[model samples]
Target: MKLISWNVNGLRACVNKGFNEYFAEEDADIFCLQETKLQEGQISLDHGEKYRQYWNYAVKKGYSGTAVFTKKEPLSVSIGIEGVEETEGRVITLEYEGFYLVNAYSPNARRDLSRLAYRLEWEDRFRAHLKRLDKQKPVVICGDLNVAHQEIDLKNPKSNNGNSGFTLEERGKMTELLASGFIDSFRHLHPDTKDVYSWWSYMPKVRERNVGWRIDYFLVSERLAPAIADARIECAVMGSDHCPVVLELNGF
Candidate 1:
């Protein structure tokens, strides 16, 4: 099975930039999106009429949200963490016979770090949620995690060290999550891969220079690692500041 995750930045804006064209070309069995930035009824997406589309929209209009488009219908769908009081529409859980797919748009620690505390708190809750799901079945977690977990994940680690996405605290939280039994599929496939990133700054020539951060990911439970046939970043595709990250699993 092939799955693709992308932080479209804004789904409506991305659609105008040929989102459907690229989506068709990829032909993912399950396609997930983050940062959709729109509420229900604002935009209609026609993914060839074959996909079973599921969306989670925030109460606030034109803000954080997520969506999933899968060719195979899920056995069940969940909006957010079961016990957590959330309203940003940051997550969608789709349960299949084989695994649970958790599509998440992690809260971004703002540029000023004002949201850092909330971001960290959310991380703990999110990790706990995944662990609970893993107890039932393997979980495929994908989206813009909003943090660059390692020094090699960004263009200039030295200069970006203390930034919101590259902060020590944020990185540590990612480490904790991985240690808790999830594997970062991309890194597992390409251990030493460097300079390849999923997200780029919108500044002039930044994308051309490939100055970017690997914030988006396709992570699976540790036991599912052997099934990861391919994990890659589609850097050449362009629509949003972020590109698509893909994971192909065998015999799933």
Candidate 2:
């Protein structure tokens, strides 16, 4: 099975920027998107008839949202974690016969980190939510996680110290998640790979210099590590500042 995750920045803007063409070329069994930044009735996709689409729009239009386009029908679909009232559309869980596929748009701390406390709370709830799902079946999780997990994840770790996405607190949560039997598919495959990033800053020359962060990812239950065929970052794609990340599995 093949899965792809990307943060499109804005679904409407991306549609005109070869989103349809790139999406068609990838031909993933399941595709998840984050940072859609739209609301209900904002945008639509016509990707032939084979793919079934599921969207969770935010209460605030042109804010945060997520979507899942899968060729295989899910047995069930959930919008957010239990006890969490997610008006921002941060979580989407699709239950398939083989595994549960979850796409998450993790909350960002912002430049001043004014929302850092809220972000931390969200992380706790999210971790608990994933653990609950694990009790039922293995999970294939992906999307724009919004954190640079280590020094290797970003270009200039020293300069980014304590920055919103590169803070110790944020990265620690990721460590805890992996410590609890979750595998970062790309990093697991290339433990020491450097300068391989998924999201680039939209400033003048960040992308050109390859100064970016691998904030997007595909993670799975530890038991499925052997099934992981390949993990890649499609850096050449250009629509959003972020690019697509892919994970290939041997069995469905």
Candidate 3:
């Protein structure tokens, strides 16, 4: 099966940038979207009419949100991790026969780190949630995790040290997650791969220089690692500041 995740930034705006065409071209069996930045009744997609669409919109307009488009129907679905109280609409989970697919958009710590406390709290709850799901079945977690895990994940680790996504605290949370029986699919495939990134700044020269971060991911439960045939970053595809991350599994 093929699963793809992307932080569209804003579904409405991306649609104008040929998002529909891009969506169809990828032809993912399941497409998970983060940072939708829209509420109910705001956007609709018809790229694949056979796919079932599920959305979790925040109470606030034009803000954080997530959605999932899947070719297979899930046994059940959920909104967010328990006790997190995510009014920003940060997560969505679909329970299939053999696995749970979670789409998430981890909160940014802000340039000043004002939201760091909340982000930490989120990490704990989020990890717990995934662990619980993993106990039931293998899990496929995807979307923008909002952190550049290691030096290889971004272009300039030395210069970007202590930045919101690269801060020690944030990187530690990621380590905690992977230690808790999850695997970072892309890193597993290309451990020494460099310069491959999923998110870039809006600055004119940043994207061109390929100065970006690998904040987005397609992480799966450790037990399912053998099924991960390939993982890729679609750096050439562009609409938002972020690009889509793809994971191909051995069996759908």
lDDT of each: 0.94, 0.93, 0.94
- Tens-place lDDT digits, model 3, residues 17-78: 97899989888899999989998888777755679999999889899899999998899999
TM-scores for all candidates: the values are 0.98, 0.98, 0.98
Cα error, residue 196 of model 3, in Å, equals 0.3
Global CA lDDT computed for model 1: 0.94
Which stretches in model 3 have alpha-carbon errors above 4 Å?
A: none
Which lDDT tens digits does candidate 1 get at residues 1-252?
A: 999999998999999998999999889999999999998888988767789999998888889899999999899999998666769999999999999999999998999999999999999999999999999999999999999999889999999988999999999999999999999999998999999999999899999999999999999999999999999999999999999999999978
Better of 1 and 2 by lDDT: 1
| Candidate 2 to truth, TM | 0.98
RMSD of 3: 0.8
Write one digit per residue (lDDT tens) for candidate 2, span 4-55. Answer: 9999999889988989999999999999999898877767677889899999
Give candidate 2's whole-model lDDT: 0.93
**By TM-score, how accurate is candidate 1?**
0.98
